[model samples]
Target: MSFPIELTAALTGASVNQLRRWSRAGLVTPEIRPSRPMLYSFRDLVALRSVCYLRSEVSLQKVKTAFSNLSEHDLTEHPAAYRFATDGTTVVVWNEDRFMDLVKNPGQFELVTINDVYRSFTNSSDRVVSDFEHPRENLSVAPDRIGGWPTIRGTRVPFDTIADLVADGDVTADEVPDFYPTVSPSAVADAVSFQEEVEGLAG
Candidate 1:
């Protein structure tokens, strides 16, 4: 499913302006953009998160160079599908066999694996009951369901899935119950609010 730019920015912890700039630079483009309202897929979120993390540690030019080098390799999988680390001087992509350095030169700099970056991203996605109060009473987190993504209580429906629908203009917050009869409008509101709060914290 595709999500609007606001939801994409919220989930990825990247500003709307940053997303636009990256899109212009061919770094992370949305899956749907046939009109004024653009939409992005999960893959785009992963790529944007990677870019945001790299830019935080190094210069934008360095991040661009690293991504350019990465494009030449066989690691074309979605950024979320793989793990990565950086030592402030170089970016490293981890594969099943070994880690591939993205930088041009290989020097004797101490390599610091930023595995926490991926962890932070995952943690942000994993919502739970504690994230909200009475409004989110129906929210839950089950490791066995949907690979641990936050879902409605007693159901496998992810909160983001509903939020995405709302952001896409496919449904209004008041009309969410029609799509998910088991969920209340208040719960839907809570889910969206909780995610926005998470995004604010991430930012």
Candidate 2:
């Protein structure tokens, strides 16, 4: 599913205005929909979030320069097919075939992972957010799932779908199972608590 600009802003650690500016500048644009509000796909989330993370490590000019070089290569792989590693001051792009220091050299791929919403992407070589399977107990995100949004482990129901249900006052933690038999009371609690925790961090 596509996300509205506001939610996209939170996930990317960017303001809506900045995201718009980037889009207009052809830096990172969302997947286009014919008649819908401008919405972002999961791929767009990864790219934009990467820009934010890299910007924190290096200067905006450096990030842009790296992206300028990145645009010159063929990007036929899935948006999250590539991997990266960074120290506080340097960034490198890695793939099975080669490695390129983004600041000193450049490459074609871009992918992201998150912990503390950013470290997993920078410090770990084994994890890719697109390939990620778990966020919390009873929650999973797999490419085969709905846009890879975290979902109730065995079902297609998104974790946020349940969290929003209770947070909106339409249900209680104990009442969730009546609506989704696969979701136990504890899963409901997990969903709500997870949502609260993420929103707090994103805020």
Which stretch of 10 consecutive residues in model 1 shows the poorest summed lDDT?
Answer: 127-136
- Clash counts for the predictions, in order: 0, 0
Error of 2 at 104 (Å): 1.2
The residue pairs that clash in candidate 1, if any, are none
The models' CA-based lDDT, in order, is: 0.64, 0.66
Best by lDDT, which number? Answer: 2
lDDT of 2 by residue, 1-203 (tens): 68677666755667888888887776777775422366987667667767777777787777666666554566445444455555556566655545566676465334443532333332354434332455544577778778778888789999988998898787887788889989977567657656875786575
Candidate 1 lDDT by residue in tens digits, 50-115: 677677777788777767766577657555555455667777665554566777453223333444
Give the TM-score comparing model 2 with the true structure, all chains together.
Answer: 0.54
Off by over 4 Å in 1: 104-203
Residue 188, candidate 1: alpha-carbon lDDT: 72
Error of 1 at 105 (Å): 3.0
